[model samples]
Target: MEFRHLGRSGLIISEIAYGNWLTHGSQVEQETATACIRAALDAGITTFDTADVYAETRAETVLGQGLKGERRAGLELLTKVYFPAGPGRNDRGLSRKHIMESIDGSLRRLQTDYIDLYQAHRYDHSTPLEETMDAFADVVRSGKALYIGVSEWTAEQIRAAHALARELHIPLVSNQPQYSALWRVIEAEVVPASEELGLGQVVWSPIAQGVLTGKYLPGARLPASTRARDDKGGAASVARWLRNDVLERVQQLKPLAAEAGLSLAQLAVAWVLQNSNVSAAIIGASRPEQVTENVKAAGVKLDAGLLKRMDEILTPVAMFDPAITAEASPQTRP
Candidate 1:
């Protein structure tokens, strides 16, 4: 597996990070989840990303079990906060209370004392940014987490946080955002800001939640057992890319994938890694073979011309508006 330094930080992580978002502890059985994690490790993936809120905190336990025998020093484990992990008013957001309590809970669930990179799952409009960053600083100082990051944060939010992170002398090294060939919202604003601030992007949904895999054909009935048919949150997460227009446009990339000698999914994953600022592309899987297949994109380099053709085909349907980044975060805590 190819490895890159996460942002300007000294920490090196695998380019292909295996993430359990909708699969582990929810859509797939624990056995399947562990098998996928093993597959990722077999394929040389050392980075694992999860969240405390995934499957209401069960995902971390499953992941912890999956990594039981592995040397902790060899893996880069990442998780997030700021989502409602519990029912109480004090159970969520980036407030000092929640951050302090949540870190201990995550450490317990993850079966690790120190998270490699702990992130804010989303921006908390209700909490002061200073309170959040200060809490993160304490988490680092306490040695519960090595570095801190934020997910789906706007460029301005990132800039403000980076200034505070510098002031606090903590390593705020990465930004986790939804990025893929179909989702280019981060390119216009977030990328530039993060690049300037010494932050790298560990992008999620590099295949647009399987839309870029060409599995959902235009006008076709929802494929049996596919993400679109999932009753779980997967369906809603991938709903925007299931439109006929988007599906039809996605189909045009088949020949390009063939020419590049890559599966549609590999093409999609590699497309994101082509950006210099992207440190890693997060891929989630229910099956072990899927993990093996997608990891091939790790060190694959796509020519500039092939990338251009992909853009021409997908640009019309792609969501590139910079405003979309800000829109992605909730105005108030959920």
Candidate 2:
């Protein structure tokens, strides 16, 4: 796989980075997780993304155990913070206290001297942006983190942080937002902002959490291992995702995927790579075969005509209402 600069940070990461979302420490057992990471490395995926809050903070330990020897140097390791890891009020957010304390915990769990990319998993509106920015600036300067990023933030908020980083002489490298054939909301604001600011867009959920993989077709039984099955959300969110119309659109991508000598997952992943704004796509796979399939997606590129056809099939909605924020989608239903 080719490499790209994570924003302007000078850190090189593989275009198809492996992410351990629900796989490591949640859905898959430790031995299985180890096998999956090795498979991704064998496929030239040098970047491995995980988070402190993923699997209630056990995922990092699984990754640490997997890449203990020569494998450690072969990767750009990433993990995130700013999610609730404990019941205490200070257990979350991007506060200085939390950022400082959390990195040590993450380092211990990830078994790394320093994280390649330390990101805020979500924006903390309650925390002062400057306080958060200053804390992150310290994370890099002190060598605890190589680079810093934020997830699910809007262009305006990104700009605010960027300016603060500039003022403080700190470099914020990238943003990890969800982008896929079915999710182009980032195209509305975040993409343009990131491009203009020289921040690379290392996107997550390029397949819409397996929706674009065409695995959940209309009338098909929900797969036992799919995110829908593992969803940690309200019933409303789950029910909306299971809608027939949504599944029909996902099913439409099957033949298109076959024509490309790929699975729908690959086609969906490749589609994200079609945009230069996308620095990389974080692909999380439950099994080694899924990693293999996703790795091949780097070789598949959709042409303009095919892209148009895809647009027609998925009917991509611009999710970022300038009136709304890039991090939060407009409410879909009551």
Candidate 3:
């Protein structure tokens, strides 16, 4: 596996990471989860990302059990705070109380003394950005978090945090956002802001939540075991008409991948990592076999011609500026 600096920090992370957003807690049993984590480690995936809100808070514990003993030492574990963990008024957002209280639980659940990176899951409209930054800075100061980052933040919000971190002399490392062949809003603004801020992007949804994998097809039923099949919350409904066209576009890439001697998945991942600014592509998988395929993609650097071919594959749809920016990408790992 290739390694990259985790957003200009001295800390090095694997080029392809295994994250537990859905599979560990929602889809797989402990046995399968153990195998998947082992597959990632064996493939040299050093990072494992989870969140406080995933699988009703069971993903972390599953990941903890999965990464026991000698294996734990080889991983850079990351988790996020600020989400509705419960029905209480104080159960969500980036309040200091929540931030402080949440990390301890995450640590315990992750079975670690310190998280390699801790991120705000989303932008909290109610909390002051400075307050959030100060609270995050404290996490680094207290040694509970090795680095601080934000997920799916707007360009302005990222700029605000970057400026505040500078004024306060706090080091903010990365921004996790959705970037894929099918979705390119980050290319417009967030990517530029992140570049200016000396922060690297560890992009999530690099495959458009499986759309880029060429799963759904025109005039076909939803795959019984995919994210789109599990979409009861209007997620699958958001791009009903557009998705068919996108899937058709993905089908065109199969021949390109065939000629390149790579799977379409590898081609998609390599396309995301093609940009120099990307630190790593977070690869989440349901089965252990998927980890190997995804990890190989990290090394499949696409040439300029291949990228142009890929653009032709997607056919340039209108940009997707998501509200919530990150949807936990449910079945995201699956």
Reference-based lDDT, each prediction: 0.94, 0.81, 0.79
User: Candidate 2 on 78-98: residue-level lDDT in tens?
Assistant: 999888777787888888888
Is 1 or 3 the stronger prediction by lDDT? 1
Stretches off by above 4 angstroms in model 2 are 231-239, 316-334
lDDT for 141 (candidate 1)? 97
Expressed as tens digits, the lDDT of each residue in 1-334 for candidate 1 is 9999999999999999999999899988789999999999999999999999999999999999999989999999999998999999989888999999999999999899899999999999999999999999999999999999999999999999999999999999999999999889999899999999999999999999889999998888888988888878488889988899999988899999999999999999999999999999999998999999999998999998998999899999998898988877788888
Off by over 4 Å in 3: 71-73, 232-242, 318-334
- Model 3: clashing residue pairs? none
Kindly list the per-residue Cα lDDT of model 3 for residues 1-334, writing each as its tens digit. Answer: 9888877788788878788776788888789999999999888888888998888788899999999785555678889987777677777788887898889889998888898889888888778778888888888889898888888887788888889988877778888877777767777677878888778888887777777777778778776777766653224643443356666777888988888888878877888888767888887888999998888886676778877877876746635564434343221111
Number of backbone collisions per candidate, in order?
Answer: 0, 1, 0
Model 3 lDDT vs. the true structure?
A: 0.79
State, as a TM-score between 0 and 1, how close model 2 is to the true structure.
0.92
